[model samples]
Target: MEVFALVGPLYRRVQRKIELDTARQGLSVGLRAVLDLLREHGPMTVPQMGRAQSISRQFVQRMVNDGAANGLVEAVPNPAHARSSLIRLTDAGRAAIEAAVAREHALLREAAGDLTTADVDTCVRVLGRMLRLFEDVDVNGQAVS
Candidate 1:
């Protein structure tokens, strides 16, 4: 329960930071998330992106549309799914993400003022374990034993 409580606040704080940083770069948090997803996992369809980000397909599509309009992302034909298009980052998109990331890194460094590498590593390890535990649990709230 304590861990679950922390998740929401932590997520919101991280999102707020991202929002602030992305705003300076003229990108919304949603679009930045989509770009980061593509950069990390390669090109993916709207559905694939939605699943990966745990967001609605419609929302992901909207972001993709916005990105396309901004010349940040382009639609490529999906070989396996004829009707679905894969979204890939353009050179401009990659540059934007790179800039966003650099800004984020600076922000994180400032935020981490006193925290050491080991402290961050320990936090990551603990959070990763909690994530795995959550993943194994079912929707009905039963643990998968």
Candidate 2:
């Protein structure tokens, strides 16, 4: 229970840091997440992104729309889905996200100065198990599984 309590505060602190860091580059938290997803997985549908993030499809759609307007992302025709297009990152998006991530990585490295790889690994394992314990629930507190 204490670990769960710590997780929420730590997450909020990191989220705040991310908002500050990304805002300088004219990106919101959602936009950064969209770019990161495209960078890691290449082109994907909006529905797929929503599923991966466990967020609303409408929310992801709004983020994609914003990214498209800013020329960070463009939608290409999907061969499998006639209705849904696959979203991919533009060169500008790639550059922006990469730079942001690199900056964040530097901050994380500084924060990790005292923590060992094994310590981090064990922490990750614990956190992952905790996440799985609630994986069946939707973001809205509805049962998903």
- 66 in model 1: Cα distance from truth in Å? 0.2
Model 2 collision count: 0
**For model 1, how does the per-residue alpha-carbon lDDT over 1-145 read when each residue is reduced to its tens digit?**
7977988898899899789878888899999999999999999999999878767899999999999999999999999999999999999999999889887788778778889999999989989998886886654566656
Q: Can you tell me which runs of candidate 2 are displaced by over 4 Å?
A: none
For model 2, the run of ten residues with the poorest summed lDDT:
108-117
At residue 43, candidate 1 shows an lDDT of 96
Off by over 4 Å in 1: 1-7, 136-145
Clashing pairs in 1: none
Q: What local lDDT score does residue 145 receive in model 2, on the 0 to 100 scale? A: 55
Going through the candidates in order, what is the number of backbone clashes in each? 0, 0
Q: For residue 30, what is the lDDT in candidate 2?
A: 98
